[model samples]
Target: MSSTQSTAQIAGSGEGGKAFPIPQGMSLSYWLQGVRASPLLDHRTTEQLSKSAEVVIIGSGMTGTLTAYELLTRPNPPKSIVILEAREMCSGATGRNAGHCKPDQYRGFAKYSELFGADQAKKVLEHQFKTWTRVVDYVRKENVACDLWVGDTLDVAMSKEVASQLAAVYNDYKAYGGKVDHINYISDSAEAEKVSRLKGAQALWAWKASTLYPWKLVAHLMKACLAKGLNLHTWTPVTSVSASPSIPAFWDVITPRGTISTPTVVYATNAYTSSVLPSFAKYIQPTAHMCDKVVPPRAYAGSRALQNSYNVRMPGGTSYSINPRSNTDGIILFGGNNPNQALLKAYLDADPNRLFDDSLSNFKPITDAVRDLTSTAFEGWSDDAPAAGIGPEYSWSGILGQSADALPFVGKVPDHPGQWICAGFHGHGMVHIFNCAPGLVTLIQGGTWADTGLPECLELTPERLAKINERANNVGKRVV
Candidate 1:
């Protein structure tokens, strides 16, 4: 079948059994609606696919596009680079995420300290903070029109229990000699409520962070890569990848179009990594997450708008990340997973690949809970009918690659010499991918791990894999 015919069939194929279909009710983000529909270099390539390239990068999201950009910009670039996308460019999690680039200032530090050591935990924080800065610098230097905004992000604790836990985590981070200059703590409940504007806020932690149009950034990078001779194929999904039968030391990338034989294959597939690399099936499990855009009333518009982004933490471990869009009439983008049992069970039990198959049936309970939460949870939100008819305008779900150990797997695939991986972001790709992509490029060029300068915890080694599996097994036993 021709590529066009194959793509048509794939689009019509309902759920397509394990193949990752873009979730139903997948509303386009405020960012994606602005970009042109056509991909940068997709149409220029021929339909026939039995091609050969020096490097074949799978998935054209941020990681894949950034990796290609780095490779093409480096001195003595690779002879051939091909990027294949399962759907439209940047339509996956990258396009669907909340667009906040805030790093975990203290919460993750405490967790990482428990998982690894204090030293490694500190490195993780430093790595994330540095990556945030790198993204800021890159966007400014490149003049990318991604509506990048640098501002403070508030982590507001609405309950005493959460407040105490955050205080303990903050103490733990500082006790380990972690940097605290950039973080501001608000322990006074009154002060937190005043600053965060959240009713019943018990405490808050504030730090410098950013928000941006992620789809725009990825599209800009892909365009630059295309200008520098990067071949891109969209609407092309890889069925499987295996060792080349004819060529030694090469792998055959099987797609509906055909096969691409290359010595090096980079899996930037993130949540879909398990579909391509079965070895990581258990390690990098796909979890579905939902986000929505809320059109606020006049109370949140223009000069009365919220000045900073937020991670609002309520009681019962419920939290939501919010970003205010000034250009969109002060509309707020809210995203989070409801802590309710039904919602959690639905998310945990559903197949990541088919979560989008029938979003209404699969996610109605969660989305309804989200709407109710938004209407009642916030400090100034009103559930009563609004004069402006303002409320949640759109709701959508996307898949997040949650690793067993809560850390991304970056570097060479274990036991697979010619294959490399840059997946498993644990739903925090924005803060991690910027630096990780560059580091992965260094590895692809045969550089040492030390040379990449990434956190040691992120290295994808056999030892780390075994430890993650053991941890998962132990947790499973406890649950049983």
Candidate 2:
């Protein structure tokens, strides 16, 4: 497809609001700036679908590409592998995120500990950090040109209540024997503000993190996989999959073009996984998140640029994930949801169909709220509007898969011996997929979850699925 046609298709995909018309000149993401012009942007190995493959993977985002990379690099690789994508390469959440690879060193420890005990909770955090480091090491070893940068990430608490809560969580984490050597906490408001470079900061927790151009990294991986005899078919949405009646032990992956029979099938579709696999309909929900790119004025540019990425916590559960791109002229990638009850209600009550559909339209209320929040929340943010205007230069929403149990479901699909799944990252795919993908490849190669070396909780066993179903059902009832 031509650039104009591609943009138009994406615009109609509902990355913006569907009920409202998209504002004129409202760009999606700065990451997609020169993507259409790149040769790897919409690559397809064959216009016609392959009749059969040894393994068939759905979705061409980071998870699918990485899974393919792992499978192809194995000692005894699959003879034939095919990747099917609904949209352009890496055009999903992987390409639309705010470029943060931060691990939850302590913030989520309390909650995870409460749910799964201290040991499992610590393993979760450890896995996240391991994934971050692995990605950094992979980038270096492969010489991937994705502008990857490792640095500290600030978790700034803007209110006294939040600060106190953070302190309590930190205490709990430490009490549970979670690692704290890498984390530096600042409690005094004065020092917090100075350290975070944000006004009204009551506390700050700094830890190791990294940022990168996600699309570029995934593209490089896709290129490597393609060179290793992987068949990539873009713009081909898999409508359904079923056991092949004629071919015993083989499954048929049905797409718009044709069906590809394979013995093994992996669903890396994430948010859209439920659409194809009805079993995950209740387990994995699609949640929309907004993100934007901002061109900083004189105050935030040049030497004054932010050195660390941030997760600024405001009052009433409001928070923003920020990443400053020095290579892109100090452009700040900012993203979050409004904490207001009304906005949350609107999103929660929105039609599931409209929410899952990918289309771009004007979301003025959200856009205005985010702009106001960013303008007032930051310490030295000036009212001076750059060429792009007072608000973000580009703003758009992307769907993320939220699991019912607040954890990803990785490994084989239950009851389907050859079918497998590696999705439901719950908005933390970048920190989880790198580790999850290799582990999934291990399972696909007849290795046990223990061999993959991932945490046991991540395994998609029958018990886990039953537990999720029980919780979901009980949520509708109450004790009176």
Candidate 3:
């Protein structure tokens, strides 16, 4: 789930403002620290744009790259497919995230059951779990050394309120006949603390998750797809899309380089989708997110490092995601809620200010809270520990898309025949993109929603869009 949306609704609907371009030199992401030297960083498929192609995909993040890869590798693939990106490859949320492929096994089951019934809720959870499995399978089968680490993720509660909430969800989901054989819950506070190895652990749940070098994974797949003839153009932003003047049943994707008229266009743009397809302006949203990375002391480093990834919930809706990158440096990625509630209030707001720009200044309190994680949230960090008090100096911000239902909007665009979307992951793209991208391939090949094998709520239907629009209008200026 999106940490920003848990407390407040600042993930403004992609509305109220014109779509802005991502400014250069944004985040110093540990995952992207060495990306500048990679040839794929600025690679363009062609020196000059072709007037036409079989398909055009916007945004070169995971969704876009995977969508193109899936299409190109199909038994009867589309010919001359092109990709358009506004910035460097994989520079979006996929590149800046904490590199988690964790699935929501029980946390959101109750909410989905309440809203869409138990069956759809099960589908949602199952879909994510399957996506995680497929991702791990792909990495293992291909032997991609992107630092893939498959292990359990601890959902630790540090407060009474969160403990009670977790208990309720767990009980409700269990009673509803949801699967729990793969999950382990430590409801006893003492046992939870012992199991999680955290100071204030109240209750905790552990389930399978995978963490890897997300940028490397996306780049590897990008290169593989390029070998199969996918036209990828980085730093070429699609300004807008419209009905082609000369070609019937075709949409012209307008970029600074040129225009491509194709009957099939995929908006895998996530946070930037509304800029090109303005109708999404009312449904999907863009929110600001922050993350930091630091080298850990020997106590939490090397072969003795934490084997489990984590989601630590503090009091008053403050939470943090801790992922020990055992695959690379012993650096732990710390991310989540801005501890200062006052800053969110002051956030370009007091209203629903947009957060599409990736360069938005990060809240210092976020860095401060994460830096002190070793002492404040953990167990057994001595004063004599190696290099204590050295906090993370590499804190950066990225943009995440938030949907009305905290799920993605996938399928054909409303009333727009050829255009399709596979975006609005709510900061949970890693779990959704694998299946969503393949499902998109099914749809592009003239398959029905049922053929796509995705959850019912994920379908981007006219009714769902209108319902979300109504909710946004009811909230008035601030669209959550």
User: Which candidate should be chosen as best, given lDDT against the real structure?
Assistant: 3
Q: What is candidate 2's local distance difference test score?
A: 0.78
Residue 403 displacement (Å), model 3: 0.8
Give the lowest summed-lDDT range of ten residues in model 2.
1-10
* lDDT (10s digit) by residue, model 2, range 220-282: 999999999999987777777888999999999987689999999999988777667776766
Ranking of models by TM-score:
3, 2, 1
Q: Model 3's lDDT to the true fold?
A: 0.80
* Residue 471 shift from truth in candidate 3, angstroms: 3.1
Instruction: For residues 1-480, write the lDDT of model 3, one tens digit per residue.
Output: 112321111221245654344444455577778677999988987888778999999888899999999898888999789988877888888988988999999988877776568889989999999999999999999998789998889999998799999889888888878898899988899999888888878999998898999999999999999999988888787777989999999999887678889999999988767778777775667777778776666567666678789998877877788888876676788876646534643663533433654554456666667756677766655444455444464666677787767789899887889988999998899999999999988998989889988999999888877776676577664333
**Model 2 quality (TM-score):** 0.91
Give the TM-score of each candidate: 0.91, 0.91, 0.92
RMSD of each: 4.5, 4.8, 4.4
Q: Write the per-residue lDDT of candidate 1 for residues 317-410, one digit (tens) a residue.
A: 7778888865444668877655553464565465444433223222455556656766665555673457655877666556777777788989
Candidate 1 vs candidate 3: the lDDT winner is 3
lDDT of 2 at 90: 79
Candidate 1 — which pairs collide?
23-356, 24-356
Worst 10 residues of 3 by lDDT: 1-10
RMSD of 1: 4.5
lDDT of each: 0.78, 0.78, 0.80
